[model samples]
Target: MIDEQKQQDSMNNEPNQDQQTESSESLEKETAAATPQETEVVAEQDSVPEVETQSVSEDDNSQQQSTDTTSTEELQAEIQNLKQKLEQEAQQRETVTAQAKRLAADFENFRRRSEAQKEEIKQNEKRETLTKILEIVDNFERARSQIKPETEGEKNIHKSYQGLYKQLVESLKSLGVSKMRPEGEPFDPYYHEAMMREPSNEYPEGTVIEELRAGYMIGDSVLRHAMVKVAAAPESSGEEENGESEKNNSEEELA
Candidate 1:
């Protein structure tokens, strides 16, 4: 009985060993297959990361190029705008300069005309005052010719009057006033007014024989015209005798 029990125990122990060996062999085969699958997954992951990195680098390069082109275009546009402004400013400056020149010329012409007008007015006033003073001088000359002194007191008064007249004539000479002597000169309507016509053998026709009124001059202009007698052609003696005979015949017819 002891031998049979020992045999049974040995048989059971042999089956247990065989089962363990088979299970160990199957586990080893499964482990070998799982190892290759895990290695392929790891390789795919690494390849995906490399592709993503290459795409990101390309995008960065394109963005940098676009930024550079935009900056250059903006700089060109700004330069064009500045150039147009400069041209406009230059034209405006020229127009303003021309207007200023015209205004200055007009003002200069106005100033000259104003000065000429003022001088003309002053000359007219001076001429009027001098003409009135000449009338007073004419009165003095008339008095001297009309009055004659007989007594000593009258002679002294006449002498004093003559002295005053001489002093007045000197003053007039200093003031550019002068008397004209038109006698024995040709009669001119500009300087002489013919008061009478006289037939004279001593003077030629159209000649001034005598001056009735004195003339005066201020500078080169005539202040007063001289009253003069112009010489004419003398009548012949035969014409005078014929005029006397006609007068006698008219008297006889009346009688």
Candidate 2:
């Protein structure tokens, strides 16, 4: 009975040892598969970080390009505005210069016209003064003609006076002075001054009877009026007798 019990115990112990060995081998195989899967997840996470970094860099580059474009546009607008301002200033300068030139031209023309007018006035005044002097020279000629040439010395004096008179006339003519004596012309109050009134049978009423001093004019300006005698109608003999009776009688005597 003891020998049989020993053999049964040995057989039970061998089966238990083999079962423990099989359980240990199965656990090792499961651990090896889990380690490989964990390694693949770690590698995928690393690759995702690289992709995010690249995306951030690309965004920074795009923002910088937009900023550069904006700056360029602002510079262009400033340049355009400055160009317009310069053009406007140039145009204003041109207008001012043109106005100044026109004013200068007008002033020059006015100055020239004023000078011409002054010269014309001076010439007219000179002509009128010379006309008055010519009448005085005519009186000298008449006085010389009335003098008698009796002796050689008188003849020589007369010749000398005549020569001097002719020389004076020639000198006056050289200065644009000339005589103006209108005969058989109607009497004018502007040119003629009546010195005396006379009854003339030959001339009509309001006619010039005689010119005592000749008139003179220079360029339509009268220098001296002619001292003249005017004609009037002849008085009747009956009118002269009536004038004598009126002078001698008083008002009481006539009543």
Candidate 3:
């Protein structure tokens, strides 16, 4: 009976050992499959970091391109502004130059006109003064002509006077001085001063009958006025004679 009990116990002990061995082998296979899956997940995560870095690089490149474009546009705008400013300055310079030229031309014209006016005034004053001096010379001539030398000493003095008078007349003639003869011409207030008026049938009214004092002229200007006589209008004597004849006829008819 003891031998049979030992065999049965040995048989039950063998089945329990086989069940423990199967559980241990299945646990090892599950551990091996889970380890390979973890390794694959770790590799994928490492590659994701590379893709993020590439995306960041692309964003930086786009930002740099935009910055360069903006800088170029700014430079162009500044260049255009400078060009416009230069044009405006050039226009202003031209305008100022034109105005300066016109001013210079006007001043030149004014200077020429002033010089001409002054010269004309100086010439007129000189002519007027010379005319007055000629009147004194004329008096000397009249005095010399009326005198007649009788003795030797009077003849010597008259000779000296005549020489001086001739010299004075010649000197005045050299300076464009000329004598004026207004006789028998029309009476003019500017060139002649009428001293007396006489009724004469030989001349018309307002006519210069005779010249009293000799006048002088320089160019077109009258240096001295001529002293002259004017003529008076003549009345008709036939009208008075006709009136007397008519009165006498009327008295005879009444008788």
Candidate 4:
């Protein structure tokens, strides 16, 4: 009875021991699986620096690209500024050209006006000089016509007068002055002032019979009119006697 009891007890204890051992082996297997998972997590953590480095490189490349874009925009802005400046300069050049042309035209006008003024002054001076010379010529002509022929020096005076007259005429010709004598010519109201009318058998009616004063022209312009006597138609014998009696009666009344 004691041996059987010992055997039973020993068999029960053996089962308990086997159960404990199996439980321990299962716990160890679960622990091992959890350990491998932890190792994998650690390895992933170790590779984090490489990923960070790659990300940093990408960020740097992006920053460089952004900087390049900013530089390109600045260059384009500079080109635009240069183009505007050039356009302004061209406009200024055109304005200056127009102003220069206006100034040149004004200068030309001034030159022409000045030349005209100078020419007018010269013509006035020449006209004054000629007028003074004409007065002297008139004096010479009166002296010669009134000289006495009986005087001993009259011949010499006449020769001197002729010489002076020739010289004077030559000088007047050079100065564009010409004498106009209208004796025995047709009546011209423009150049002649009729001081007397006379009946004449030798000339037609209204013919210039005599010139009391000679006319003159200077450069196509009349300087003086001719004092003239015009002829009238001849009167009949009875009309002439009547006219003479009236002229004598007027003369006797004035006396």
Q: For residues 160-230, what per-residue lDDT tens digits would candidate 2 score against the true structure?
A: 98888888888776665555463345568888777766665678877876777766554456666777777
Q: What is the lDDT of residue 19 in candidate 1?
A: 97
What does each candidate score in C-alpha RMSD? 9.0, 10.7, 11.9, 10.2
- The models' CA-based lDDT, in order, is 0.83, 0.75, 0.83, 0.83
**Cα lDDT tens digits for candidate 3, 1-255:** 999999999999999999999988998988897888888998889889999999999999999999999999999999999999999999999999999999999999999999999998999888878977887887886787788789999999988988988888788888878889898999999998888776567999889888777888877878888888888665467634787664443211100
Runs of candidate 2 with Cα error greater than 4 angstroms are 1-80, 117-136, 145-152, 193-207, 219-223, 230-255
TM-scores for candidates 1 onward, in order = 0.61, 0.55, 0.61, 0.56
Give the lDDT of residue 68 in candidate 1: 88
Residue-by-residue lDDT tens digits, candidate 4, 1-255: 999999999999999999999999999999897998889888999899889999999999999999999999999999999999999999999999999999999999999999999987987787778777877777877877887567768788788887998799899988898988798889988888888777778999989888777777788776667778888777677765786674443211100
Native-referenced Cα lDDT, model 2: 0.75
Candidate 2: pairs in clash: none
- Clash count list over all predictions: 0, 0, 0, 0
Q: Stretches of candidate 4 above 4 Å error?
A: 1-65, 143-152, 181-212, 220-255
Better of 3 and 4 by TM-score: 3
Between candidates 1 and 4, the one scoring higher on lDDT is: 1
Please identify which of the two predictions, 3 or 4, would achieve the higher lDDT against the true structure: 3
